[model samples]
Every structure is written in C-alpha cells, then in structure tokens.
Target: MSDWKTLFHKDQFRFIDHTNSIEPVTALDAFAVDDALALSVEKGASPTTMRIWTHDQTVVLGIPDARLPFIKEGVSWLNQQGYQAVVRNSGGLAVVLDKGVMNITLLFADGNKIGIHEGYQMMVGFIQELFADYTDQIKAFEVKGSYCPGDYDLSIDGKKFAGISQRRVKNGVAVQIYLSIEADNQARAKLIESFYKLGLQGEKSKFAYPTVEPNTMEALATLLNKPLTIDFVKNRIREKLTDLTKELQQNDLTAIEKEMYQKRKQQMIVRNKKALGDLFHE
Candidate 1:
C-alpha cells in the first residue's frame, strides 16, 4: 500500500465543504463541480483539493448502465421510488446516493504520473487513515454482489461500506469515493438490485451487470458499531487533512472554476438527456 502521505504531502491544501451548501446542489451538479475542480488543479489555478459533498435521493449510473435493454423503464422505476436517475461521466455502474452517503473527491494535478491502481490505492489509504481510530480492519477488495463493485471497495470483515472511482481530466485526477456513513445500506443495495432486474428483465447484454446481494453491503456506523454522524466524519477528515498538510484553506470555487463548471454542467445535461431520453428532466 502506498503511503497516503506520498500523495497528500503538500504545502497547501484546499478544502471545499459542499455537504451543506446554502444552495441546493444535485448529484449532476456535483459531478460538474468535480470536473471544474480538476481543470482548475490541472491549470495550477488551485492546489490539491479535498471536496466533501452529499446529495439527496439519487441513483448515479455509468455509461454502460444507460445501455441496459429496458433502461427507460428502469429509470422510470427509480423516479417512482423518489430517486432521480442520472448517468455519471465517470467510470462505474449504478450507485445509490442519499443524505446518509458522504462523498469525498481528492483532486490533484499530474495525474499522468499516477497509474490507475496507484490513484485508487491513494484513496484506500486515505480512507483507512480517516477511520484509523475506530478500526484498523478496513480492507480494500471487491465485495461481490455490491453495486459498483471494484477492487478498491472499502470494507470491514466482509461487508462493503464504500467504493472508490477515478476520473481524470487532462493532467488532473479526481479520485472519488462514496461512503455509506449512516443509512440503510441494504436498502440502497436492494434498490440497485431491483433497478438491474427491471433494466435487464432477464435479457442478455454485452455489459455484465452486478448481481447485487443486499447483505454484502453495510454502513460505516453499523460496521463500527458507533453513533457516527456525517458531521463527525467531516471533522475527522478535516483533522486528518490538517495533519497531512502545512496549510489547510477552505474556500468556494474561483471565477475560472465557475466558468468551467457552467460548461461542464451543460455537458452533463446533454449527456443525461442522451442517456435518459424522454425520462430526462431538469
């Protein structure tokens, strides 16, 4: 495992907290924000950044998910369940995001220097450090039957509590992870299972969809058996970041980043429309 300090050691680090933004921000906007931040970091307009964000009921799908045989029906089903469906511009299968899920994005420059596995290891290492006080049992390995299953899935014992994915924009990389902080992890997994069932309808597709088993997933609070809140987790992230960097600065997007955000957001709107067709709506 690569030492997280290798990736995190910096003179200055920017921390952006969008977990409770004054204005409403959806998962779609969150993806765009990450893209903007990636561009800013690549351009040296910003330092290494750690962004904490959360979204309400939403199911973010990967490009291949949009190709499900009965995707239109699957998306409609998600909407009926009060969960908005949107296709993400990143790599991954369908993932459930809600108030209880906390997302962290580590954006940094010179992504070309890092291999895909290395990038993922950085996130795995950082997450392990974040909860080091709670448990040293966090393992990074694919949790079969979990949504968005990956080799870098963060888990305790055997149940998965988090999944990491990466998106590289030019020379910048945004390594993102969604942590099931405090929620019904099984419920979220079951939702994805049903979505796949409806989308596939037992039909075969070129892409292999996951066989989701609700029991294979869990939340961090449950795994740790602790009364963990999102705020509590956020404080831990701040403390760990402060200890890793010389200076920690909290601020909003810059003017250039705002401009890039609008452009990236428009691209996302177009992508979602193309994927969801008539089902797509603002």
Candidate 2:
C-alpha cells in the first residue's frame, strides 16, 4: 500500500446518502460542502462524511480543457446533444456527467504530515477493499480510450468504470471521484470524443488529450457481469462505511454548512461562467 495520509486516521467514519436524486449543481458547491464537512470533522462536530451526489446531462470539464482551440464549437456541440457544459476547478480533462453516474466525495482533515499522493492512495485503497469480495483485479491504470482517463482510473480489463480527482482547502481535503455506476457508456464516450474534436479543431495544443475510442468504456453492470444498479453501489458503500468505523450516522447539512453551501453556491455560478469565458474568449 502507498503511504496513505495519516492526518485523518482518527476521524470518525460518516455517510450521507442522496440516492437517485437529480442535482443540477456545480463542482464549486461540491468543493464547498467538502470543506465544511472536513472542518466539522476537524472540530469533532461530526464524523468523516461520505457524500454522494448525482447530476443529469451535464459536462464537467477540467481547467486545461477550457483552453481548447475551439472550445466554443465543442460546447455548442454538447448543447446540441442536450448536455450542459461547465468547467470544474480540478484536474483531469472532459467527462460527461449524468443521472446514471455516482459521485463520492470523501471529506477529511489531513494534518500537517499528509502529502498529495498519500491522500489519493487512501481512497484508492478504500475502493479496492470495498470491492474485495467481488474481485481483486481492479487496478489503477490510465484507460486509453476512456473519458477522463487518469493514473487512478479504475477499470476492469482495461475498460474504465471510474475516475478520481482531488481538491484541498485549508488543511481539509476532498478526494472526489465519479463512478459510471449505470449508464450508456458508449453515448457518454461519444459525447466527449465529439467535444474533443470540436474543441481541438485539428489544431495544436500544449496539453495532449486522449484520442477517445468510445467502445473501450463500459458500465459497472456490464463489467461485473451482473445486474448492478446505483442502489447496489450505494449499499456497498454503506457496508464499507459500517466496517471502517465504530459508528455511522444518517444526517443532513448543519446550520453552518447550509450557510456556507449557499455562499459557495453563488461562487459556483461565477466559477462556471468564468471558466467558460476563459475558454471561449470573444
């Protein structure tokens, strides 16, 4: 195992479930919620929360993704395909987000001793362990034809089912990742590949993106050879949460967190526009 972040070993194990809810939210709000929950954990007000959120027909792009030569054309293509496009202040390139995807945001406070790789390693370990009963062949490798391919992309036999990204704020870290739990993986890949073609426009760019091949990506159901649903993944997460901690709580946002969510939500609106404008500068 890699050197996992030690700053959060003592934090409580927590879980929050928003199962099958359609939330048309920004990544900024997600980051803010992560920060607040992490602070709450640091203060011992709550357990280390595992938050799950879902969005429908939205395209979340990375910062570098915004700089594509023909981003406007790419975005226009997405809108025509009925997908909302927004920029996420995080790593990775373009990814198609929708109702069928399950996003898990793990919030915790890592003390001074934590490094970036260690933080990511912790989540990687958790996912592998959670699915240990099913199989141990889940490896971290860049899925060449998958949308949002990364070093931590989780796949079964080279077909990616999930991608992980991280954000750090004030000693609190939000290791966020999205699992294509259930969806039309082919359609999702085609959408992103089109976006890349339109955005890149056969022009040279500083950052090299994957030449996406839609056939190479798949859903958890198809990969697992079973009728896997979001409910199954949710339950699996709950099962893992129970085993990792002594106590698990089912709860809602606190007063402070509510206020922060609203404030940071407005910031999200600004971020979305700023990101688009930066990419599609007139």
Candidate 3:
C-alpha cells in the first residue's frame, strides 16, 4: 500500500463533519456539496479538504442503472421498501446509503496531474491506515458479488465492507467512499439484489449487473469483531488527519461555495428529473 503521507502531505487539512447536523441534508445535497468543494479546491479558494457525511434511506444509482429495462418498476419497488432512489453524477453502479453508512470525501487540487489509479490508491491507503490498529488484513480488489464492486473495494477475509469511487471536477479530484460501518450489510446487499432482479426482469442488457450475493458483504463492526459506531470511526478519521498534517481545522462552506452549491444542486435536480422522469421526486 502506498504511504498516505507521501500521497497527501500538506501543512493543513480542512475538516467538515455533517454526520450529526440537525439540518436535513439529503444525498442530492451531499453530491452537490462535493462538487462545490471540488471547484473551490481547484480554484485555490480552499485547501485540501476532508468531508464526512451520512444520509438516511437512499439508493444512489449510476447513469447506466437508470437505463435498466424495468427501471420504473425497480424504482417503485425501492420506494415501496421505504428508500428513495436517485442517480448520482459520479461513476459507479447503485449503492445503498443509510444512517449506518458513513461517506468520506477527500478533495484536493492538481487533479489534472493525478492518474486515475493514483486517486484510488490514495483512498485505499487512507482507509488502511485508519484501521491499522484493528487489523492489517484490509485488501483492495474487486469483490465480484458485492454492490458497486470495483478495483478499490475494501475487504477482509473475502467479505467486502466498503467501496470507493472518484469524481474529478476541473483541476480537483474527490475520492469518495461509503463504509458499511455498523448495519445489516447482508440486508443491504439483498436490497440491491432485488432491485436488479426487478429491473432486469429476466431481460438481457448490455450492462452486466452483478449477481449480488448477500453473504459476500459484511459490515466493519462484524468483520472486525468490535462494537464500532459512526462516531468512533469519525474520531479515528480526525485523529488520522491530525497526524498526517501539521494542522487540522474545522471550516464551513464560504459564500462562494454556498453559491456554487446552489447551482450544482440545481443541476442535480435537473439531472435527476431527466434521468428518473416520472419516477423522480424530491
């Protein structure tokens, strides 16, 4: 694994924690926030930033997922099961996000010079270091039967606990990850499995959806055999950031970023409407 410090060495790191905010911020807002942060970092208005966010019941889908044969029915099923579905502006298949799932995004400048694989490696290295005390068995490889399977899937003992995705805006890159810290991961996998089943309806499509096996996914609390909570993981992240950089400062969105967020959020709204059509709702 690449040393995280070598990849992300900086004098200061800005931290934004929205995990326990009283204000309601949906997954749509979360993605928009990342876009605004990316632009800010790219323009040198913001430093390297580490943001933590979580949402309630939401299924974030990829562009191709919206094209599934019976997508309307699939989305209806998700709604029936008390989950709202939205297509994200990033690259990846459908992923389940709930209160139990903690999302972390690292945004920094110089995206033009960073190779795609290096962006992924930076996240992998950071995750490994975060849990180094518990175990050194975290490995990054494609977990074939898991939702949003990718080359940067974080797993232990053959069971995946997290997945990573990347989004680049102008000269900045945001490496995003969803960690199944403490929840029924099997149930989460099963939810996606049923979604695909309904969406495909036994019909063939160019995109090959994974044959999701619920047993292939496990939560970090279960995999580590420790009672882990979102708060615990957040603290670990803060400690790691402090150790990696000379200073860690808590910052809020500036006026420019807030304005950018509104524009990005509107784009997200329009994108979802076009992608989901009648199925899209606030």
Candidate 4:
C-alpha cells in the first residue's frame, strides 16, 4: 500500500474542478494537457498536475473504435441518442461519459525512476484510500466485459467501476481514468454493445471489437449499494489530496496552458476529421 503522499509527493498539483465551468474542458482537453505537460517538463516551467474533468452524454471512442467495420453506423446510432461521439487520442476502446462519470488525469514527469506499474499503482492506491470508507477490499484486475477493459480496471468484488489508460509523451505521462461513480452502468454498457453491433453490422472486418456484456458492468453505486454522484467522487479526491499534502491549489488552465491548448485543439480537430469522416457520406 503506497502512501498517497509518496505518490503525489509534496508538489502542487495544477488541479481543476470541472464541477465549476471555465471554457468547458472536455475529455479531449487532455490531448492538449499531454502535449503541454510534455513540453513543460522539458523546459522545467511547472510541476505535475492532476486535472479533473467531467463530460455529460459523450461517447469517447478509441482509435480501434474509429476503425470499426461499421463505424459510421455505430457513430450515427450514438448521435441519434443525443450522445456526441469523438475519438480520443489515447488507447482503449469506446467508453460512455456522462455527468455522473468523472475523469481524472494525473500528469507526471518521471526522470526514469517511475515505471509503468508504479504510476498505475499510485492511482490504484489513491482510489483505495479515497473509497476507504466504502470498502477496503478493492482489487486491480482486468474486467473482460468492460468497455475499455484493462489490467488495472478498478473493481470491487467482481464488478468494475473504473478503468485507467496511460499515455507517455516524451518525459511526461498522462494517466487518465473514467470513473463511473454514479449512473446506470448497465445502460452505459448496453449502449456500447449496441455500438459494436451497429458498427460491425455482422460484417467481417480486419479489426476486432469487444462483445460487451452488460452484466459485467456495474457502477460504484451498485457495487457499494449507495447512491453516488460525480460530486461525491470529486469531494473524495479533494479530501485525499488536501490531506496528503499541506497545500492544495486547484487551478484552471493558465495562459501558458491556453496557448499550448489551442495548438493541440487544432491537432484534435484534424485527428477527428480523419477518425470520423463526414457521416453525410453514410
């Protein structure tokens, strides 16, 4: 059990609470953060940041998702449900994001001492401490039926509530996770399963997508038998981070960050255009 203090250390985490708005930093916001932090680390302008963001009714697809045999059909299905679809610049498959879902990205600069497991463990440890009051027996294991299933999927008992993905750029690593603190997890799962069906249309393609099983998906509320919300999870993060370190500075995108963000935003636009072609052709 690594201590939270050791993981975050005594540095200032450029934090942002999305519960309050400022230019609407969506999940794609981190595509910029990743680039900015990677540069900041190279120039030594700032310390690591733990940015928190939340998006409502958005379908974040993975690169593989964009390559789905019938991606146009799948994306169209999502749009019909009033869910905006965008392929992220990170790994992993399709994931459902909503107000009830909160995303946490820990931007860190490792001078080569931190390995992959170490960075991931820090988050796992933080979640354990955050939800300490709920259950102490949480485990990090791959949940097969999970949408973005990974080895470090956060689970209590047998159901998953969160999944983490890592992207390393230069010396900085942005570890991002989408936690379903609250919401109808089964409904979310069903959405992606439908997406796979529509995206593939039973057509044999070179790419393979997960056959999502809704039964394997469960929200933190269902796992803990308590009504939960993103606010609850945000509060948990604040308490843990604040308690671990003497200073807690929750911040928004600074001028420097904004400058860098704009560039990455354009990059995202180009990437999206490639990933999601004009559905008008559909």
Q: What C-alpha lDDT does candidate 4 achieve relative to the native structure?
A: 0.78
Query: How do the residues 84-200 of candidate 1 rate in per-residue lDDT, one tens digit apiece?
Result: 988899899999999899999999898888788888888888898888888999999989989999999999999999999999999899999999999799999999999999999
Instruction: Give stretches of model 2 more than 4 Å off.
Output: 1-11, 21-28, 42-44, 278-282
The lDDT of each candidate is 0.92, 0.75, 0.91, 0.78
Poorly placed runs, candidate 1 (over 4 Å): none
Model 3 residue 194 CA deviation (Å) reads 0.4
Query: What lDDT would candidate 3 get against the real structure?
Result: 0.91
Cα distance off (Å), candidate 4, residue 68: 1.0
Error of 2 at 204 (Å): 1.0
- By lDDT, the better pick of 1 and 2 is 1
lDDT order of candidates, best first? Answer: 1, 3, 4, 2
Candidates sorted by TM-score, descending order? 1, 3, 4, 2
What are the RMSDs of all candidates, in order? 1.1, 3.0, 1.3, 2.5
Candidate 3's TM-score: 0.97
Output the better candidate (1/4) by lDDT. Answer: 1
Give one digit per residue, the lDDT tens place, for model 4 in 7-59. 56655655667665655566566566666765665456666677777877888
- Model 3 spans with C-alpha error above 4 angstroms: 1-3
Q: What tens digits encode model 3's per-residue C-alpha lDDT throughout 9-79?
A: 77777999989875337898889999999999999898899999999899999999999999999999999
Global fold similarity of model 1 (TM-score): 0.98
